[model samples]
Target: MKEGNVISERFLLNNERALRLFNGYAKDLPIIDYHNHLPPQEIAENKQFVNLTEIWLKGDHYKWRGMRTLGVDENLITGTASDKEKFMAWAEVVPSTIRNPLFHWTHMELKNPFGVNSFLNKDSAMSVYKHCNELLSQDEFSTQGLLNHYKVKMVGTTDDPCDDLKWHQQLLDSSFTAKVKPSFRPDKALMIEKTQQFKQYVQALSEVSGIQIKDIESLVAALKSRVEFFAAHGCSISDHGLAALPYSYVLTDAEKREFESFLKTDGSVYSNPDAFAGYILTELSKLYHEKGWVQQFHLGAIRNNNLGMFAKLGADAGYDSIGDYKHAERMSAFFGNLSLTDQLTKTIIYNLNPADNEVFAAMTGNFADGRMKGKMQFGSGWWFLDQKDGIEKQLNTLSNLGMVSNFVGMLTDSRSFLSYSRHEYFRRILCNLFGTEMENGQLPDDEEWMGKIISDICYYNAEAYFNLK
Candidate 1:
C-alpha cells in the first residue's frame, strides 16, 4: 500500500555489511563478453533503440518461450503487438515467474537502468514501463552508452562465414569505446544436409570470397578463405552448436567422396546426417588448430521438431526443446579423438543438459594441461541453464571439479539488447554464492581475495583466456 520511491536510501548499501562486501566486489568491474549473438551492425553504428520493449523483448526467445508457456499467443511474441501491450503482458507474467531467473533479471534491469525500486506487476507495470521507455529515448541509453555504462571492455559476436565483415571493419576503423570482435560460427554451412539452404549459402560464400565452388575441395577452400578473412578482422574464436559431440570414426577418402556425390544428387543428403556433420566438424577443428583460434562447442540442444509451429513461425521461434542425448562418454570419445592427434586448440565446452555438468566439467579438466589450468574451459551455464539455479550449479560444479577463479564469465548468448542484464544477474548470483560461502566459513572471509575472484570470473578470465586486449 506504500508509494514507491525511485531512489530510496534504504536501497543503498555502504561498504560495511555483507551486501556491501558483495557490491564492493561487483561494482565497476569491466565486462568481457566472450560469446554472444548481438548484431554487430547495431554496435558499429552506435544505434539508439526506439524503446525498452523493442530492445529487450523483441528477439529474446527465452522471454518468448515463457510468454507462450503463460498462454500468450505467438502473434504477441513475434508478430504485431504494440510495445506497450507486450511489456504489459510481460509485466502481468513477471510475478508468476518468481523462482525463475527471468524474475531476477527483470528486476535487475529495472533497478539498474531506471532506478526503479518496485516490482513489475499489473499495478506498477505502467509506471515502470513509462520510466524505462523515457530513459531509452535519452542519449545515455544508446547501445554504446549502455555498454559504457556496464563497463564492458570487449564482446565477441557470433558471425557466419558468408558475412562481409563490414560491421567489424567499421568498428575497427572507428574509435569505439568497447572492442567488438567476431567469432566464426560455421554451423549453417557445415550442416550440409539442409540442401537448398546449403546450396544457397555456398553460392553466397563463393560470391563473397570470389571462389567458384564446384566440388567439396573448392567448398573447403572457400570456407578456408572466409576463415582467414574473419581472422584478419580480429576473430580469435570459432563456435559450433551441435546436438552432441562429433564422434564419427575417422572417415576414409572413399567415404568422403561418396558423401560429396550424394550432396550433388537431389540436393538432399539427410540419409547420413551424423557422418556428414562429424566430417565437417573434424575439418573445422583442423582449421581452428591451424589458425590457433579457440574453438567453442555448444552441445546438447535438440532443436525445432514441431512441424506445425515450425511451418507457421520458422526456426528459433521457441519450438526447440532440450535433448536427452547420452552425452558424457560419447563426448569423451570426441574430445579424445581431437586430443590424440594434438590437434586440439583451446576449447570451451558448454553442455545444455545440467545432468552432465559434473561429467562435462570434470571431462574438460582432463583435457587441460597443467601448463594452463583453465585453458580448456567448461563454459558458463547456457540456454535453460542461464538462470540463477543453473548458474549456481555450473559455478559450484566448476569450483568443485575445476577452478572457478579461472572461469570465462557470463555471456549473453542472446539475440536481444536488453539481455545485457544477464551479466548483472550472473554477477549478483556469483557474489551471493561467495558471500554465503564466506559467511558460512566455507571460504575464508577475506574481501580482497574474494574481490579478485569475483573480478576474475566476471571479467579477467575471459580476457586472459581469449587473449583479448
Candidate 2:
C-alpha cells in the first residue's frame, strides 16, 4: 500500500482471466463534474481540511444513514462525540459493510491518501486515523490538492439566487487550475410554503438586483437579473429538485392570474402545491431558454416528515427517502408540455430510484431528435445510486436502451470533499464492465475503439455535452 497508489495490477487490471481485458485506458483523466453540492466558497478560497472525520464524516448523509442502519447512536453521528470516537464507531461498522460501496470508497481514500493498506477497524483505527490527520496537515491534501489528485477540470456547484457570488468571483480571480462555476438552484425561493424563508430570499434577491419584486413579473425580472449575474461568472446551468415532475393540466391565464393574486394576498401561492410548482417550472424553463443555459431536474425524492427528529437535527439528517412517483407518464407529460414550444434547453433528468432506470433511460430517447442523443440526457445515477452497482446499472441501461457513448459521466452529488473518490470508484466499475464485455467477445478487442469509449464515459461526453472549455 503505497501513497498515490490508486490502481493495482491485481484489481484494476486484474490478471484473473475474466477481468484482464478491462484494463485498456488511463486510470486518471480530467473530470468534467457537471453537478455537485460542494460549497463554491471553499474551492474559491482553497480551504485546508482539519481532520479525517471532519472532512469525511461530517455533513455526509450517506455515512450518517449507514451509521443509523448499523444502530450506532446519533451522538456518534451528529452529536457532540469526539472525532476519534466517531471514527472508531464507523470502523466498527465497516466489516459489516463488506459488499457495500462504502467499504471500497473508504479503503480507496485510505490507500490513496495515507498509504495505509490495513483494514480499518477497532485494531487499526488509531494508526490509520492519526496518519490521515497528519497527511491532511500537509500542503498536498488541501482542497485544491484533492481536486488535482483526481484531475477535476471543472465543477458546477449548486447555489441559490441569494448567494453573493463573492466566492465564485474568487475562483475566477484565483490562479488555481480547476474551474469552479456557479449553478442557480432556486428551490427555496419557489417553495413558497416556507413563508419566512421565502420572504427572506425575495428580499435578498431584490437587494442583490436592486429591483423591488412586488409581483410575479417583477419576481421573474429579479430572477433573470440574477441569472445574468451568474452567467457573467461562468454559469451555464440551472438545477431543480422536486418530488416529481410538475404536470398541472396546463393552467389557464385566469388560473395563473388567480395564483398570482394568491401570492399577493398571502405572501405565497403553494396552497395548491402542484399547480404552483408546475407554473414555476414552466417559467424557469422560459428563463433557461432566454439565457441559453442547460436545465437539470433531479426528481423523485421523499423528504422529511419525522417532525421530532427534523426539529432537533434539521433537514437532510438521514430522514429523506425515495418516492414512489408515477415517474414515466408524469415525465412524459412534463416533456410533452415543453415539446409544444421549441424553448426546451439542453436538459438532463436524474432519478433517485433504480426501478425507474428503464423508464428514465427510455424516456430520454423519445425526446432526443436523433440530431443529438446527448442533447436530452438521462443524468448519472444520483443520490441513492451514486455507488458502484448503481453506476454500473445506469451505464448498462443507457448503453442498451439509449446511446451510452453519448452519456455524461460521473458527478459528485455530494457535500463532502472525500466523496471525490466516488469518481475513481465509478471509473473502475466502468472499465471492468467494458473489459469483461470485450473479453467475452460481446465488444471489439481494439484498444483504440475501447479507449475512445472509456474516455467518453470518463471525461469527453461531459465536456462535449456541456460545451466546457
TM-score of 2: 0.93
Which pairs clash (backbone N, Cα, C closer than 3 Å) in model 1?
A: none
lDDT of 1 by residue, 1-469 (tens): 2335532332323224346554677666788887888899998888898877888888777788899898987777787888888888888998888877677677776776667768889998887777788888898888888888878788889998988899999999998878899999988876666778877887798899898876657777888898899999999899988888755746567766775676567645555566666766777788898998999989888998788988888888777877888777777777788788988889999999999899889888878867775878899999989887898899999999998888888998887666777887777678878877787788888988888888788877788888875
lDDT score, candidate 1, position 86: 88
Q: Which pairs of residues have clashing backbones in candidate 2?
A: 22-435
lDDT of 2 by residue, 1-469 (tens): 2333333544544333224333445365787788888888778777788889988898988888888888999999999999989989998898877778777777776776567766777777787788889989988788888888878898889998878889889878878988888899988756666766777777788898898877666777888888888889899999999888766735566765765566467554445556666766788888787787889999999988678989999998888988888888888887778778876778999999999999999998878766665888988888888777788889989988999888788888888777776777777777777777777888887767877878787888788777775
Q: Report the Cα lDDT for residue 187, model 1.
A: 89
TM-scores vs. true structure, each candidate: 0.92, 0.93
Backbone clash pairs in model 2 (N, Cα, C under 3 Å; residues 3+ apart or in different chains), count: 1
